[model samples]
Target chain A: MGEGMIQDQSDEDLMKAVAKANQSAFRTLVNRHMGRANTIAMRSLPRREDAEEAVQDSFCKIWVNAASFDPDKAKFMTWFVRILTNTCLDKIRSNPPRAGDIDALADVLADDAASYDAQYGQKREGEAIRKAVQTLPDRQRMAVILCYFEEMTNPQAAEVLGINVKALEGLLVRARRDLKGRLGAGEDNDG
Target chain B: MTDDDLKKRLRAWTVPAPDSGLADRIVMNALRHPQKMPWSLRLGKTLETWLLDWNAGAIYKCASLAMIVVIGLSIGYSSPYAGGADTISIVDLAMGGMNEWEGS
Candidate 1:
């Protein structure tokens, strides 16, 4: 059993272990995906405290629902990000911001900068990229976070967003175009 | 910049490390509540498994009983002396007595 376990410790394995109440295996999974999960939450909610809460809530849900995971349908991270994204979206819709709320916008930008600093040691360029990402529409932003930031494939991102792959591709295209526009880069400019 | 380049740069942005206690807190919360598996689901699974086992056992028993019945019926039908020879002795006895009386 030990040999078999050593040979086959995929996310699925860890999840099964989690279902059996294995704390070590659960911790391993959290360590592996927590950073990306946090990023997705932060991108969607654009606030540190809320994002952190969302991540924690999502992980908790995952722990509870580990037995329901279907490996054939989606990878573990894809499933996980879907939960995180939904939690963030629920938070957003529950309290829709007023039109032209500059304070809200500034708070979002400041949160992004602070999160980046917390993660990457104060890179101005990183903050700029995040600010640009913040300009994307919600769905487009989600697609980008899942596709690029989380390193998920288009189909996986689409699954997380409950959209078709073609739609996901379009969202990604528009998101990239928007990012390029806001970052002062032209169609020819290659970062 | 090209879209690919912009995407690449955006991808390069890193997420800062979360709060040091975040994982512990999440794990602790999970341990505390531990999603309750619904009784209905548990009952359904149990019933499904039991039904499968019962169906297989019933099928085997029914097939065995059928084979036994078939073999018993075949043996009974193929026996030549089953119900045919019992009255033959009485008929022979009566015929012999009649023949003797006629001869006397």
Candidate 2:
């Protein structure tokens, strides 16, 4: 099919084509989702390079498992995000964060850490808040990342994490509380 | 922090959009590795290999002949109904001195 035709195809249709080992369809898919995949990876892992590695690893996996995916079970975006999340997590575990990893996460957590599309620079207050967020437990950090940073709906984030909505909610509540405590009383909820 | 502040800061986070060339790179990498076919495709390929891709009409004839031989052997030698429903077995017939060895 023509490029326009491929671009117009639904994610599921492209996925079906991918299952047939269609290289063009796979290219279209990678172009479409790579941005958000990168964003999620940046938030999930400690370094930009690590995030890149994770995204690359994930695309390779998607290629391998394309035929096994069932559209009825989940949306393509959700499934892809789940794979990216798992890949990033594995990369994070395999290479333990350096001693200054918290500093690295804090640096990347800034408002302008990657804001390529716009002039998004992190303010001092926001930096403190993000550092607080980075200090959360892995699951709690993931909860915050998906629900807040990635702007995923609670149910959707829960689905991606392979947890029930209630469990995800509990993690968010705890993460928020932890962030608030770290940020302190009056400034905790500051804008 | 306030939910709005948190969301705003997150929106500002400088996460890189993957390089435009990365997609092409991934496609090339995948091509080099030629992924395994799904089971359904493999099954279809198997049918084509064993049945459709050969000297077409002869495959079915040979398959049919093989089936006939297997069925005939089962009935004549290993079949429980060899003597009859009420009869015991080929072994029983031999032990009772009711039959001689085949080709004797």
lDDT of 2 by residue, B33-104 (tens): 657666887888777877766665576779898999999988787656655644456568666574454445
Provide the TM-score of chain A alone for each candidate, in the order shown: 0.74, 0.84
Error of model 1, residue A138, in angstroms: 1.2
Best by lDDT: 2
Candidate 2 lDDT, tens digit per residue, A15-127? 99988888889999988888888878777776777878788878888888888788999999899989988887687778866758757645544445365533333444545
Pairs of residues at least 3 apart in sequence or in different chains that clash in candidate 1: A119-B16, A119-B17, A185-B1, A186-B1, A189-B1, A189-B2, A191-B5
* Candidate 2 positional error at A86, Å: 0.9
List ranges where model 1 is wrong by over 4 Å: A1-8, A96-122, A185-191, B38-41, B45-104
Relative to the unseen true structure, what is the C-alpha lDDT of residue A190 in candidate 2, on a scale of 0 to 100?
Answer: 55
- Cα deviation in Å at residue A84, candidate 1? 1.6
